[model samples]
Target: MAFFGFKDIDKLSEVDMAIYRYIVDHDEQVPYMRVRDLATGAHASNSSVMRFIHKIGYSSFPEFKVSFQTENQDLKNSNDDILTMFTRDAFPNDIEKTIKLVAHLMLDADNIIFIGMGASGAIAEYASRQAASLGFNCYAMKDPYYPLVQQLHNTSNNVLVTLSVSGKTIELVEMLNNFVNSADTVLTSITGNIESPIARIGRYALSYNVEETRIHKYYDLTSQVPAVYLVDGLLKELHNQDVARRIN
Candidate 1:
């Protein structure tokens, strides 16, 4: 379910994540495939595939396949109520802590940039408006190609909040990669898959687990409600902290 609940998900390179996602998404076909076949399917070199396999704690390809199959055997398909997918306890332990920490980052930030593509872009826009209403300098970049310098504040801390259901969206990932090394910018990501590439790169990563669904195999119908909740949660926490500081 989570790359077999792998402990070193944070260590996976982007290429390794591609292979991991490919295998998970095409679970039925992977157990029978050779290393070369997996490389072809995941659009990576055989060496990359092997690296990922070993990273997940397998000594050999066959051993990895056997473990993967055992882990996936209990996976069952089910339709989930999008509304109830997130509950009070939905936040994982790490995310619960990150939410508290990120609130401080937002409170101190000179700029808060919300980035996303497609459906997530809509949510990013919504979050920006909400954050702006709280008097934070926030901008939503719906288009991945938008020049960040247009609204960037170079004099102070900048927080980049990325929203994605599948954290593997190429455009968003590439954009994050460009800013990953900036000392003035802080990276935060809200994704359905906490182990996704974007999540791994974020200084703060929050995740809400939900079954990924698609219509016509092209349109991702993954629920954005959890993402909305996380945005509101972060904003609410930020508000509380700001109010407390004012009162103090």
Candidate 2:
């Protein structure tokens, strides 16, 4: 059961638990079943099945199935190359688009604010300093007060860049939601969980697909490599644009 140990089964709703139990019990059959079929087997609603998939940290059912297969195959093959895993899992298409978007936003915004906590906060700080070196007026806000002050002053010409592995950090999500509801600030997020609440709130969301397992759950092995890749890419693009503008 790949999904088993990645998520706390006890925390799931009764309907979601039913769906999860059905999937685990019928792991071999689940990959072939339709959403409705799974719902029927679990005695849960179609919506419950969908929600269960997202709740278990997958953007979609197909993605969930693919991750399950990939993880199982990797285990059998004993694939242990971390760099190869990062390269294989990173979403190149989304990465390019996200870099372009970040560059464009930075060019037009009066100020840029990077926000995060924990490991992501450190990444945010590094990204902010990098952006500053590129001549953008940017700063990282690990504390809540600075962002709140910025929000109080002016938000229309500001961009908020948030980083989180789970995309479900309660504090970050609440703050982002407040900004979205109250002002015209541009919001962007870098996260591994594409379907998470903070990811959904961001006007521009960039995601990297890292398969979670029991090891990651206990060890907190979420990598900042993807986020660093994004920031570094964005910086390069911004520099190129600057050079192009000067030449023009």
TM-score of 1: 0.64
In Å, residue 77's CA in model 2 sits off its true spot by 12
lDDT of each: 0.86, 0.79
Instruction: Please provide TM-scores, in order, for all candidate models, with all chains considered together.
Output: 0.64, 0.61
Instruction: Give the winner by TM-score.
Output: 1
The segments of candidate 1 whose C-alpha lies over 4 angstroms from its true place after superposition are 1-83, 149-155
Kindly list the per-residue Cα lDDT of model 1 for residues 1-248, writing each as its tens digit.
24568877788889988998999889999989999999999999999999888778788999888878776775533324424666766668676677889999999899898999999999999999999999999889988877674446355599999999999999888878877888888999999888999999998888888779999999998878889988998999999999999999
Candidate 2 local lDDT, 18-99, one digit each (tens): 7877877887777778889999999988888999888878888888888876665566467567447577456746678777
Model 2 worst lDDT run, 10 consecutive residues: 212-221
